[model samples]
Target: MKYEVVIGLEIHLELQTCSKLFCSCSTTFGKEPNTNCCPICLGLPGSLPAFNRRAIELAVTAALVLNSNVQLKSRFDRKNYFYPDLPKAYQISQYDQPLAKGGYLRIETDGNYRNIKLERVHLEEEAGKLIHSGESIIGSDYSLVDYNRAGIPLLEIVTAPDITCGREARLFLEDLRSILLYSGASDCRMEEGSLRCDANISLRPSGSDKLGTKAEVKNMNSFRSVELALNFEARRQAEILVAGGTITQETRHWDEEKKLTIPLRSKEGSSDYRYFPEPDLLPLILEDNLIKEISAALPELPAARRERLKEQFGLDSSEAALFTVNRSLGDFFEEAAGKYSDYKNLAKWVQGDLLYYLRESGKTVEEVDPQQFIELLALLDAGEINRPVAKDLLNEMILKGTSPQIMVQKKGLGRISGDEQLLPLVEKVIDENPGAVENYRQGKDKAIAFLVGRVLARSGGRADPGEVNQILKEKISRG
Candidate 1:
């Protein structure tokens, strides 16, 4: 019997705030371990917790962007757990009354769009990291706990189990990340552990309405790994069911390097993490006007902006889609292209030249130097270099941060556009390549390739092949 995969995602995004949720400590990443922890974050006795108002505003702003219903009354609950990572031994999270509910995010895939119903988007505090040199959370070594990440405000977005396939789930995540970046709520940098995902997946018979035993997969740091982990789990579960073996409901570990899921523990009861309302904090009451204010502040999201870019810039669907995937990347393209009349060439240069250099240099588009990119585009417009030479110069700029003009000078990549400078090279190539010249006169039309090669070799590949080809045809035809 064929099996169908059902998947749901729980995405956790660390809010981009100046301070932690319950204290005034820095929430910035990359600080020295435990340097940013405060009394409230460290759970010192007699320290009172105050909710960060800015954190609430950011969370509400994100909820509005997702079209969620902003709740008038929301409360924080203490989720009790004892771990080295969680400094308080309890995570202050939203349990019953969340900030938003009943929102739906529209995700597009393969020219079709679908909605993933939101269960809730709740506010919570992040745990820190435990770096151990041993295996299985045990064995020989003592672990170092970094409490800097603890108490950082996080938004947990839980979705209904409506996803049907791994590919659809991946698209949902991409769109979700786009929305997060566009909203400016979070950077959504998965590699930095700012944005994380946990997927719950199960497989059932194709025609059955009943849900089967599901497994939760976590520790996937990238979109590619999420899809891969889900796919592997679904296949593994289906094979077990087909062979009449029972699949266990458990929480599994996603071994990213191994590209497989390993059983972590049985998913049965939550006995230890006793959750209760914290006596120290009061209920958060979200006002209607406050919600309205944030709702009004919401910008044109990815899909709407994509449509606008396609229509306003005269770009195709695919071009617009490519540009809008990353907000900063798309902003750079428009910042460069919108000023000029020929956005088509700008699009081509960005996707072809800009994207190529980013790959070659192993850098992100955000890490690119906008001034150098603008200079390269300006050179292409000013006829300082031809297409291939411009590409070489761009590669040099990316690899060495060398100025494009410097590359042109040092590598002799300047175009020979002027006939005065190009004619001597053209004439010399014609005289020496007699067989090719003879072939050109004898109507072996493809011999133009040979003449072009001779001219380029003499010019150290600096001559514009287009001009050389044109100059050669004319020189060979002279009476």
Candidate 2:
């Protein structure tokens, strides 16, 4: 019997805000351990909570970008739990009244596009990190707690079970991340855990009417890991059912090193943590004008930007998708496109030479001042330097933080425009190499390559190869 896998995701994105969700404490990452914490964010007793307006605006923008319906009223609920990392022993989150719902994400997979429905988008506070023992993986002697991230605003997006396979699920996540980043709602940095995912997966017979019992998979720190974990769990469930065994609903941990999923506990045995409404904060009500303003301010999402870049900039779909991944790279491409009419050539050089220099130097596209890039492209367009020398100048500029124009002046890497400046060297080489001259006379046409090489060596490679080829062909014919 054949089976089909079904999957859905609960993605928590850290909202890019200046302050924490329930307090005025700074929400900056990589601060001195717990330096950004305050009484409310630290879950101190007698400290009342207040919501950050910017966080709500970002959530609204994110929902709008996802095509979600923004609710006029939403309230926060208290999710009670007990963990070493949770100082309050309860997390403040949304329960019945999420801010947004009924959205859909469009992802291209398996040579086709599929729409995945979003159940809801809610606001919540983040939990702290857990440090483990040096020798043991699970056992802990003692762990230091940093409340710095405790109350950071988060947007939780839950998906429906419309995803068919692991690849489709991964594609949906990538598109969602792109939308969030493009909307300026979240940084969506998976490596730093600013974007976290928990997946629910189940398997059933191809023609079955009932949905099989599902398992939740966690500890997927990357997009690739998410796909792998889901693939493994689906196959595991299918194997169990095919062998006439029952599939259990449970929580599983993805062992990335082992490339497998391990069952943690059954859903029936899991703690509820008892969700309730918070009394400290009032319910959030959105004014229609504020929602309209945020909708107007929302930048073009990834799909819209990708389509526009393809149409306006003459970039192919794939090339446009690559260029639109980040705002800095997209801006750089547009600025360079403004100076050069040849979009194909500009795209090749920007994606190839420019990206290479930036990655090798460990700098972002934003780190390179636009003036430096503009001058480098200008030198190439003016024909003052050849392609190889231009690449070398780009490397120097990246490494030493100097402009390509200044480096060209300092190194005298200019074109030898006149043969009067070049013929003398060509003559010396021809007289010195009589055998090659004899070969050229005998109709071995490639022998002209000899004169070109000799001229290049003598001219310090400053001579243009086109001009060198012209002069060499003339002298070799006379010889």
Candidate 3:
């Protein structure tokens, strides 16, 4: 019997706030261990927690972006648990009264768009990081805890089990990250641990509505890892079911290097947390006026931007999607588009050559001047320099931040467009290659292309290809 894989993701995003969620401690990353902690963050005696107002605003903004309905009165609750990373012995999080709920995000996969419904977007504090000296946490002889990440504000986005496969899961996360970055809510940097994901997946018989025993897979640091881990877990569960064995519901860790999921422990249910409403903090009351302000302040999201790039700029869906994934790159393209007349050529340079140079030189779009890039495109348009020279000049400009025109003049990289200078070289190429000339005369049109390449080779890539082709066609036809 064939089976279908079901996946749901619990994404944790650390909000871009200056301070901790319920304390005055710094939220800066890469600090000395425990250096950013304070009395409240460290959970010392006689300390009380105070919520950060900025965190609330950013959270509400994110909810609005995701189309979630923000609750007017949401309260915090104590999630009772005992762990080494939790200094408070219980974490302050939202239980029954979350900040937002009933939202969905659309993802395009397999040439079809589908909406992945969101379960909830709640507020919580991050736990500390655990450092293990040995290969694995279970094998470590000693461990260390860094509380710098503790008490940091985190937004938990829980999604429904609507994803049918691993590829869909990866697409959803990519789109979600783009949305988060566009909103300025979080950086969503997976390497820095600012954004993390844990997937719950199961495999049931095809066309069955009953959910199978699912496993929660953790330690997936990247998007690729999430997809691979879910695939492995789904296959493992399917094999067990096919062999008439039961799949135990447990929490598993994705061993990325080994490409397998190792069982961590039994999965915990809601009753295990022993949750209750916190007494220290009052219920969060969002005014209607504030919601309206946030909604109005929302920028054009990724989906809308993609569509606009396609319709307004004449970019295909793939090109538009590629440009809009990085907000800085998209802004650069838009700024250049305002000045350049050729929209398709501008898109090609930005998406193709500009992106390639940026990656190779270890630079960003901000490092290059838009005016300088526009000047380069203008030079190409005017036939002042050929494409090869323009590409080399672009690389130089990206590396040294020099002017494209100045470099072209200094290096003598101007295109040999004048027919007076190029006619002799075109004549030389035609005289030396009699076989190609004969082939062109005999109706083999591709032979003239060979003669043009010879003329360009003799000109050191400085000759205008269009002029060479025109001159060669005229001379070959005359012969």
Compute each candidate's TM-score over C-alphas. Answer: 0.90, 0.93, 0.93
Model 1 lDDT tens row, 353-400: 788788878977776666677777787778777777788788877777
TM-score winner, 1 or 3 = 3
Relative to the true structure, how large is the alpha-carbon lDDT of every model? 0.85, 0.85, 0.92
Full-model lDDT, candidate 3: 0.92
Question: Going through the candidates in order, what is the number of backbone clashes in each?
Answer: 0, 0, 0
lDDT of 2: 0.85
| CA RMSD of each candidate after superposition | 2.8, 2.2, 2.6
In lDDT terms, how accurate is model 1?
A: 0.85
**Residue 15 lDDT in model 1?**
91
- Measured by lDDT, the strongest candidate is 3
Tens-place lDDT digits, model 3, residues 177-267: 9998999899999999999999999888899999988999999989999999988988899889999999998999999889999999998
Error of 2 at 221 (Å): 1.0
**Cα TM-score of candidate 1:** 0.90
